[model samples]
Target: MIAFPDEAAGCPLTGIVASYTPRLAALAAEPGFVAAVDQHAAEIRERLFAQGPELMPRPLRRAELTDYALGFLDALAEVGWDQPVGYDYAVDRLTAICWLVHQNGLLDA
Candidate 1:
């Protein structure tokens, strides 16, 4: 498992991933998975912005936010929870998410 900095653990992206990854892995091919991705991605965007510009990197860009959230979701969708590979993939995705959020300069409250 990826260990996010204590600060970033509360982030909504982190929340969504931590909460949904297992479910997603099990349901990736299910009918509503695509909708769920969209819904969660949107929620991530809303929550991120709600954290305020003061908490984010200066000159925040929308593109990066979308890319990271979507990419994370896509990663989760690619692996099955029942497979050992899925565990590794989850770790990798978590790592990427932590790095991206930090690289973008989001500060935890």
Candidate 2:
């Protein structure tokens, strides 16, 4: 079992996803947006490799990233879906998502 201090036990991904699902869902609905995110991730991969391979892990395909994004949104819907989430929060989530994709890749890939 994962143990976190009570004050920090809330999952950042879960909270961020829950807070921003509607916006993410809307973006996910657009093929253009998904493609752009994939392209951006590819760029990120290149930049990350420039830093060094030791910093990277197994690369994730664009579809896998999209699946994770969409799944996060779906999980959010299961909880309270009426809370208002800010645009800034949505942007932050997007940035973090891209960073996650980058971190999950290896330089050789």
Candidate 3:
């Protein structure tokens, strides 16, 4: 039997994929998803400006902010969450993942 994941266990990306994937598209799509993506991406910009984008081998440029955020949301929308209802939930998870990945560099390799 298929088991739906809880809030924290599943990544935001999973939620994105679940809702938008061809195998399972969201019954209701969220209109605010684009705005949410912009908001999330803006946060990345602020962070990069404040500290630095030296997470990679070489330093990243400030212009990469929008692209990264767009890519991130697009990735989640395209491959992670799949439900319109899960947008906010995905945002919560995205916030954590963003902080972990960018701020703390927890996901940095």
- List where candidate 3 sits over 4 angstroms from the true fold: 1-30, 51-85, 89-109
Which has the higher lDDT value, candidate number 1 or candidate number 3? 1
> What lDDT would each prediction earn against the true structure?
0.46, 0.46, 0.43
Q: How many clashes show up in model 2?
A: 0
TM-score: model 3 vs. ground truth = 0.28
Superposed Cα RMSD, model 3: 11.6
List, residue by residue over 1-109, the lDDT tens digit for candidate 3: 1122331242343333333333122213543654555465455556555563664433445235334444666666566565454556555435433432343343234
What is candidate 2's lDDT per residue for 40-108, written digit by digit as tens?
546544543444557655455554555555564565556634434433333544545645544454111
| TM-score of decoy 2 | 0.32
Error of 3 at 18 (Å): 11
lDDT of 1 at 42: 48
Report the C-alpha displacement of residue 48, candidate 3, in angstroms: 2.2
Model 3 score (lDDT) = 0.43
Q: Report the lDDT tens digits of candidate 1 across residue range 1-109.
A: 2222332432345553444445545445754544544454345555555565566624445355645555655555665333344334444444344444544554333
Query: Candidates' TM-scores?
Result: 0.31, 0.32, 0.28
In candidate 2, stretches whose alpha carbon ends up further than 4 angstroms from where it belongs are 1-24, 51-109
